[model samples]
Target: MPFKTEEMLLNVGPQHPSTHGVLHLEVTTDGELVTNAEPTIGYLHRCFEKYAETLTYQQIIPYTDRLDYLSSMNNNFGFVVAVEKLMGISVCERAERIRVIMAELNRIASHLMFIGSFSNDLGAMTPFLWCFRDREEILKIFEEVSGARLLYNYYRIGGLAADLTPGIEDRIHSFLNQFEAHMLELDDLFTRNAIVIARLKGVGMIPRETAIAYGLSGPMLRASGVDWDCRRDEPYSIYPSLRFEVPVGGEKLGALGDCYARYLVRRAEIDQSVSLVRQCLTDIPPGDVKEQVKRNVRPPVGEVYVRTENPRGEIGFYLRSDGSTKPSRVKVRAPSFCNMSVFNRISKDILVADMIAILGSVDIVLGEIDR
Candidate 1:
């Protein structure tokens, strides 16, 4: 078996739909097995960071939305948090509660696509349509609040774009109630489905230590038995005041941190998000959501890095200000970019089709990766 084989080179994307958003994998294979895989990115790059230097702080918020477009609210939160930290602004209690609601809702939206696309990759088409059906509700909420369906640009430096329109809270409440049923349906349909379980349970086994060493975070890290979460560990934006559990790895995984483990971890996190949103609805106070900042914007001449747990992982921004109208430099440390790096190491010895499943489970947005 070792004597007569030749390695065949295969180019898998940059145009192929299965590669998922302009991702190109240069795969080297021996027969049906992948021997080496390298991810090629930058295709979707829009130079958002460089563009940030020229725009006012407020102008850059929409650009962040485009990064992880599926979780635009989360992106809005991250960009605004960095600017708020720079300007020494803290959001009010009501604003904090609303931010949590929006962020968690976006998390649900992003993960639904994960469940849908992951199953779809395995030849299950119905899940994709069902996922969009539920996710449409989330987009509707975003549209009502921010006046845009996808890229909301809803967060201001010190607060949000506007207070929730009347009945928005009630709508969110209704949506969450229905949302719980959707998660349960999803679990019944796929999480425990025999085919999905068999294909993903022990596949793509990334260990706890390897995950940490590779800088994995979010569900990926949690699935590897690490209990660290930026929401729980380094709390910001009222997360410190909320009550929620960080769902880590469980025994069903056989201590094998595989794709299924990550999937289950996110599934459980969605439930936790539901609980958190309900709590916010109960405890939210009545007040001005925005902090009244000086009409002109300026920050001290210094650099600071702020990181938060996005649905993908720890999304951080390194911001440098020169006490001017614009930031001197802005560097976005996207989690997908870091997590996707693990693909080359993890995909070795897997089949091409299995590689697609693993990639979808990783749940990367190429816009964020390429930005």
Candidate 2:
């Protein structure tokens, strides 16, 4: 029996908890099936690129922190790496080790947030609390090091703001010792749950071609069976020396491009980050990790783009300097912005409920998207 159903316009965003941030989804649906969905952005726009034009190279570091607040340390890492490359300068090995430590720890913290919030979006509340419980430990580490929790203005042009505090290594090691155990508990409770598998598996499939065509990076691309990580492929800082596994969509883990694949890739990444942090903690050489270089950092009159692996995706900074205290051009290639592009295409003809699951898997942070 055929039933008469008319297309209707629905708005899921700008205020909805699941849209992730100040994002609006203009969705057209027929009954419970969606025909089209598009994203409306800029509600959280802060004019970061335009504002960077007036601020010095060093002054813009804090602004990058705002782009992806959950991965503030990695945001700082990407920007400074770009600035350092632009200026043709390098920091000491100790600073590099410390930088890697902070970035990887931030990676772990950010991924934990993803697991929690993404699980919460799927109606699993226990994983949310458990993930955040461990994330708090990372926040405490950041606070003791950078004096700020959310938006850390720590990384400088050629070095860091300061050295690791005494016994912080012990603190991180202690946290890691238990975080692994908690992850196992989560694995038993949520990862292998029949409900979670039913909700995520084989839905929101982004084939390898579609993923590459949309310029997807990080876990989004890897989840679609593409094994490319900017940290490994485009070696920068101390990543070339770190040994870690890059998880892709595999038979044993997740089928290609599905939401479950995305989840598995990120879950595996957390363990790799744990290995990285442990590596750095054990071998941080002694050095003067001060706010190296003066406030006025003038690079040569040239342009360079530096890309680093962020929790969401690849974060690239395209910087143009005029041999002055400030940059003439600063453009950011935010990963969430690119990852969000393919949402509507994959959304067509799917149930409205599945659309929500797809969006959650995208894991966008509107701060970066709007910028």
Highest lDDT against the true fold, candidate:
2
Give the RMSD in angstroms, all C-alphas superposed, for model 1: 1.6
Lowest lDDT block of 10, candidate 2: 283-292
- Report every candidate's CA lDDT: 0.86, 0.91
lDDT of 2 at 236: 94
Error of 2 at 343 (Å): 0.6
The CA-based lDDT of model 1 is what? 0.86
How much is the lDDT of residue 208 in candidate 1? 83
How much is the lDDT of residue 73 in candidate 2? 94
For model 1, which pairs clash?
Answer: none
lDDT of 2 at 26: 96
Q: What is the TM-score of each candidate against the true structure?
A: 0.96, 0.98
Q: Please list the residue runs of candidate 1 whose C-alpha ends up more than 4 Å from where it truly belongs after superposition.
A: 1-4, 252-254
- Per-residue lDDT tens digits of candidate 1, residues 94-128? 88888889899888888888877778888888788
